[model samples]
Target: MSRVSDTEPCGTETAVRSTRPKDLTSRSSFGVLGTLYSAGEQGLALDAHRSLSRSTLLRLRDRRTGAFIEEFTAWADGFGEYRVRLTARARRHYAHHHACYRELYPDIDTPVPRPTDGAHGGLVDHRADRDPARNLLREADVLVLDALIRLQGGEIGRLQKPPIGRYQRGTSPEIGAMPPGLLYREAEKLANSRKPISRLLQHPDGPLVAVVEVTSLLPWAATGSIPLPALIVLTTRGRDHYESHLDSYRRAYPDLDLQLSRHTM
Candidate 1:
């Protein structure tokens, strides 16, 4: 993995033109190049390089953990020029709700959604107006919030009585097999609605004393120079109202590394 020289002239432009597919215009080709370049510049190392039919495969790994972060398939024309495409691994990571990758590498850029060919032979743009990175960040925060609830001896789900009527028609296997509980069903509803689950966990009368927002992701690691994530505590009452509960939580779970701050609105 050689460092791309700052002095190099039109290096990315040349690479894009060389590897550009017949269906991709120059603008889209540059977009792909930008994705690859941004990842490399953000401290991800090129871990694997292999030759494919008319292209090269490159896998980027985290230098610290040696985990595969992104994979790019680079194509070359007959004149020895290059262009890159983000393959399965990179695409799936962004599309799914998994938080490990973003938790590990928070600074890496969110990839530009790839364009696809339409039925009528013209290029169809699939660029979304939504920000995947922001969504992932909220998801990661919810996971941390869930962990905090569990640490405080709160059960996430409880058994509930089933409906009096018989099973409905066209019920999916998952729904039929679902454990009787409001938590699971509510979680599914929130997920389907693309809403954050942090709000679902809130109960003013429950053991959870305050609403929390994870201000950082670096704290997911057990040991690192990186500072722990900060928790912004929001409560209807003053901060002093929750001090006892917060202190108890800290005393009960000393291993949980978090910096707590209060913000009232």
Candidate 2:
């Protein structure tokens, strides 16, 4: 056997690489699984399904939709069928629900709850991110997945609300009420306060991210910011309020990729 060659560049030498056996002891798998679960949590999770069961979902949807229907029953005279189908969930959530928002519920402003200390110290707690986090994410995933499925020729699930487009003219005075100019104004107000668009220093090396109001882009689009970041919108009210805007807002910002979550509201 002809043997050694000193002229071989050190870079070209191939040594026996450490090959860890794949099994339960693999640390890498846990990390990957954690990431997958985190990603999966971005939509509604199973526990949420139990908490916000089909009955509860219908109640919330119908309550909200019914309120809208009542307000615009006359103007939306011909669209009764549409409203009935859409606002089913809203009706449930708002039905006899007398809890006023801290802001609007009581005439006096209510103090915001302080964030709690944790092992991560001010880092957003995954659990606090939502109640029954897994369930919420699963539900959201189902919502989007259903939409895509319908686009792929599957039957569309009956949406609790008839989308923004189907809202009766009477119920949605805010829609046509905003002229192009006002869209800019409202969007700017939201941008300035709840939806400020800026890069956080913590993520300087990554893709630019901004937490903006779902309505901010309405103005940006009007002002010719043709493209905007995909936003995660929040509301002070509750999850129900936030979910109401998800589809329309997602369609608004197709780029600046990310999932839209209901953080505050």
Candidate 3:
């Protein structure tokens, strides 16, 4: 394995500037080194598992104290893996979801929800044969998954762009007006396009900021092992609510390069 080190002083400015758009496009996979750096952690080592592949292991440390923080691994397919030591506050948030998972699926062996798990991720059962719920849980996952596929496919500039005009909410001032039930019908059409998978984390109590933290500690996917970065799009109100609790979210999901965007309409 070959090891690449950045021993010079590390900070968010340096890290962001170092990561060129070309790097994201050219690499077969990406690691959390840049994420950690942007989070104010120093990357101690960036090692390649093989010279020819994008698989890598990154070690991070505290920039001020030089204390070891954590390690992140990215596979050649662009799927990222990492184990994080959650803080007390983060554990409190996770505890609620963990308990809910156990209550909802008693027979499932998975102890905790992971974003990559086909069944347990997003705290929802995404099987096509399963009975549909009255809630919007399934629809939310479909929306996010469709958005990711489009974003990765270069069909859109950001996640906020609606995949189709029908998906746009008429209530939004930016979208003007639309026929009644138009958005709902379009969503159903999008949902019917593919087998459902868990791609969103929903918390009944408030904004999705807490669930965002849970996703950061786990591998994210739209379907199967397809590699895509963690990205969230919210309405104007949702974005404001998320920003209001930004500090807590930051503490819970430190060292994550989560992309956030607001809906276009």
* lDDT (Cα, tens digit) per residue for candidate 1, span 88-193: 3333323331122223233444453333222111111111212222222233233334333333232333211233123222323433333222333343342343
* TM-score-sorted candidate list, best first: 3, 1, 2
Q: Which runs of model 2 end up more than 4 angstroms from their true locations?
A: 1-86, 96-130, 134-142, 150-153, 156-265
Give residue 193's lDDT in candidate 3 (0 to 100): 35
So what's the TM-score on candidate 3?
0.21
lDDT by residue for model 2 (1-265), tens: 1111234332332212232211111122222222222323132322322222332223222331121111112123454321111122222222111121221223322233233222112112212332333322223222332232232232322211235332222344443333212122332332333222222112233322223432443443434334433333222222333345445433322111223442322
**RMSD, each candidate, Å?**
19.6, 26.6, 19.8
Best by TM-score: 3
Estimated TM-score for each candidate: 0.19, 0.18, 0.21
Backbone clash pairs for candidate 1 read 19-83
Residue 217's lDDT in candidate 1: 23
What does the lDDT read for residue 3 in candidate 3? 30
Worst 10 residues of 3 by lDDT: 21-30
**Clash totals, every prediction:** 1, 39, 0
CA-RMSD of model 1: 19.6
Report the C-alpha displacement of residue 168, candidate 1, in angstroms. 50
